[model samples]
Target: MFSPEGPGLRELAVQALSSVERGYDLLAPKFDHTPFRTPDAVLDAVAAALTRMGPFGNGLDLCCGTGAGTVVPARVCRDSVTGVDFSAGMLAVARRRALPAGPRVHWVRADARALPFAPVFDLVVSFGAFGHFLPRELPGLFAQVRSVLRPGGRFAFPLVAPPRPGSPAYWALLGFDAVMRVRNAVWRPPFVMYYRTFRPSDVRRELTRAGFRVELHALPEFGRRRDGSPRVRLVVARRPAR
Candidate 1:
């Protein structure tokens, strides 16, 4: 689903064929018009949830493509905020957008696995970026986040419940992943984005091993599932204060 201003099918096909960085570069200008961008509703909901638990000093948005989730930290942090991503194109687009009235915002182009920063941030948040990381990379990825956070700092992100097996959504995601696998097998510089790899249980265990005390908070915006579990949850993983 995309707006008229979004990339055309031909443009999308070209992007899909390019490396992930270059593909995002081609799409950055029209990213906000595409479904690929994180929605404002989700951002607002995350902001609300974070606001309840914060008055943080400084914040970082890890893998902050187009800075959609940067607003969450800008709302909750007191001093300064930074948005980091590997794509210069995306960072350029993010830099052009006017930020809300909050902390000073800076954009940096850097890989998430090897962030260039001190452990000085009080809060770190990411949205819609986990799919880029494979399951095997979770430990190093979580460690990178932990390394950039101050003692007692938090690394927060929202997770939606996976679609039930046999559901249409389930089939759709499975098919998407299958297609991606086949595409990567035949393509150069694989574009890694999988919808089903980031399970909560596995993530929690990895976060724990990364030295974070993890907690889950229900986001009331999405309500509950039939099984009484929250449809959406904010995973708040804190670095030890000591």
Candidate 2:
């Protein structure tokens, strides 16, 4: 699932052996060419959905590697837009891009678990970065998002449905997780990425605990699964307005 411009097998092997932040630093230049980057289609769908939900001001993109989803907020938010990540390398790559003519764009290097911001953002969006966090970390991560948002502001992201049980996709993810678990058990500074850790129920509950009113909006552009469930959904969790 990697293009020729992406990291090669030897480079990927070296990255896999490094810590998550360092691995991403090494992969930053070629990340967009890999399947690891959030897809443009997903970003477009979220942007359209947010356009309906907003006329927001001062947006933040949490874990915004390479700034793929930064454009979404720059379109919907009236004020400035900030993209935050722990990887300086990723932020450097993002800073090189010519942003659209809308809100002013700022790239900051910060970890999502402990963001260095006030409760100033009216909207926050994150894409394809949750798998980097473990289940226990969700409470703190969601809390961090809530802390940075203004009352009634939303923290949104797309959540794809889990692959069908016994299907090739399902087995592939399961196998990937199994491999990761084993690797972490033996490796130092564990690379914590898993496909199955974030479930809808668990996420909703965690969002609620984090003081967000959680809701889901089906993304029809991705179509429905055989079980009649939306294949892709936008998880829009808003901090309650006082």
Candidate 3:
């Protein structure tokens, strides 16, 4: 599912073997050409939803690889926008791109577990980055996001519905996670990315514990599943405006 400009299979293999930081560093240059980049459609849809809820001031994009999701906040936030990620290489690539008109853009290199910022943001958004975090890490990660947001600020992200059991997509994800588990068992520095670990119910509970008033908004652009559930839903978790 990659373009010719994307990394080759050999390059991908090398990346998979490296530490998460180094692997992303090696892959950063070609990341936009790969399926790893968040799609513009998803970004645009999120931006539209945020616009309805916002007149947000400063915004932040956590784990902003190549800054795709940063565009959403840039569209909604009137003041400044920042992107934070652990990978210097990914941040470097994100910094090189031209941003859409909205706010001034800044890029920061920091781990999501321990962000370096004041609680000044009015909105925050992330895309396709949570898979890097294990289930046990969710509480701390959500706390970190909550810590950086001003009272009344939001932490938003989209969640695609999980594949139905016995489907090809389900089997593929299961197989991928199985391979990753085996690899981590046998490999050096573990590269953490799993498909099925982030469940909506678990996430909502953790966000609640992290002090966010969570809400779900269905994104109509992706339509519904056979069961009539939203194919995609946006999680808008707001810090209580005390």
TM-score of predicted structure 2: 0.98
lDDT of 1 by residue, 1-242 (tens): 89999999999999888888999998899998998788888899999989999989999999999987898999899999999999888999999888889799989999999999999999999999999999999999999999999999999999999999999999999999999999999999899889999999999999999999999999999999999999999999999999
The residue pairs in collision within model 3 are none
Give per-residue lDDT, candidate 2, residue 5: 91
Error of model 2, residue 139, in angstroms: 0.5
Mind giving the per-residue lDDT tens digits that candidate 2 earns over 1-242?
89889899999989888899999999999999999888889999999999999899999999999998788898899989999999998999999977789898999999999999999999999999999999999999999999999999999999999888999999999999999999899999899899999998999999999899999999989999878999999999999999
In model 1, where do residues sit more than 4 Å from their true spots? none
- In order, what lDDT does every prediction score? 0.93, 0.93, 0.94
> Candidate 3 residues 87-135, lDDT tens each?
9889999998888886899999999999999899999899999999999
**How does residue 109 of candidate 3 score in lDDT?**
93
User: TM-score for every candidate vs. truth?
Assistant: 0.98, 0.98, 0.99
**Regions more than 4 Å wrong, model 2:** none
Candidate 2, clashing residue pairs?
none
Q: Stretches of candidate 3 above 4 Å error?
A: none
